[model samples]
Target: MKFLYILGLIVLLSFVIIYYQFNPEVYSFFPECPFHKYLHLDCPGCGSQRAIHALLHLNLQKAMGYNLLLVFSLPILALQLFCKIYSYFTKKTLLLHFWYSPNTPKIIFVIVMIFWIARNLPYPPFNYLAA
Candidate 1:
């Protein structure tokens, strides 16, 4: 199991390097958004691949242009990643003050749903939110 976990980590790290080195827009190997491809609508995660590539290169503006919500959420994701890594290495979990409320997931779900609908709206500001 540990060996498998290490292998997965290596694969994940290799992909991070690949994302940093290559632009997803110029790369055909990257996966397409099935939701967008089929429905012609931008999903919550539409530009995530391109955004990840831009973020890996430290191009915050480009990353945000690709996915505004994703850019805003990176710090939270990074914090979770930090906690997971620390716990994995130290065999002790950090007592974070997040997600203690039962309503957290429900709140997040509502937020994502709102973002999805708002970004798909065909108006000036909302159109800007589209990937």
Candidate 2:
């Protein structure tokens, strides 16, 4: 089952990369967030697709311009996926530790608040950090 899940995910990721490469300009099915549109502010995930697209093309500068956070997240996600695969194959559960307890709701709340506040700042370098 785990193997199947990972295989399916690989297929899905492959399809997304292909789609983004061939049809970069056709993502309008994703509706604009009203707050971002009205306020002319970026949401944390605003340029994630573009970042991924740039990453696929090996354009680091363009990816960073799109969303530095999303680009940074790729490594963490890769690590997590690797751990999952390793455990699945070895039949040994690997413990994932966090500085904070693994409380989903608290983590999500903190993440959202941080993103909301971080993207709103007008500081020169930090402002450019937003998506």
Candidate 3:
């Protein structure tokens, strides 16, 4: 199981490295988001690919410009992933108690929905939120 996890990480890292070398925004092979294609509106995940590409290249400002939500959420997500992996390897949980609450999922969902809407707004300031 540990080996599989490590292998997955390696594969993912390799992909990121490749993506960093080749900008996804210029790659014709990268899939366009169907939600945005049909609706002509930016989705919550619309710029995530470009953001990851920028991040892997150590361009923080470009990453944030592509997807601020993804840029901001990455550290928290990495910490959560690290905690899970640590628990699996050590059989001892780390900071699990601090993350869980009855309303956490609901709150996260609401925030995502709000971001989705805000990014799709056709006005100033909010319009800049779109990719």
TM-score winner: 3
How well is each residue in 1-131 modelled by candidate 1, as lDDT tens digits? 67876897899899999998889899799989999999999999999899999899889998988898899988987787778778878999775566567888898899899999989999988898899
For residues 1-131, what per-residue lDDT tens digits would candidate 2 score against the true structure? 97798788899888776756653447675446677789888877777777777888888999998788788768867787778878978999764555236685597578767876787799976687677
TM-score for each candidate, following the candidate numbering: 0.88, 0.73, 0.89
Positional deviation of residue 49's Cα in model 2 after best superposition, in angstroms: 0.6
Instruction: Give RMSD (Å) of candidate 1 vs. truth.
Output: 1.8
Candidate 2 TM-score over all chains jointly: 0.73
Question: How many clashes does the backbone of model 3 have?
Answer: 0
- Clash pairs of candidate 3? none
* Candidate 3 residue-wise lDDT, 16-50, digit = tens: 77887888889888889999999898989999999
Clash count per candidate: 0, 0, 0
List lDDT for all candidates, in order: 0.88, 0.75, 0.88
lDDT of 1 at 7: 90
**TM value for model 1:** 0.88
Error of 3 at 13 (Å): 1.7
Order of all candidates by TM-score, from best down to worst? 3, 1, 2
Candidate 2 off by > 4 Å: 2-7, 23-31, 103-112
Could you list the CA RMSD of all candidates, in the order they appear? 1.8, 3.2, 1.6
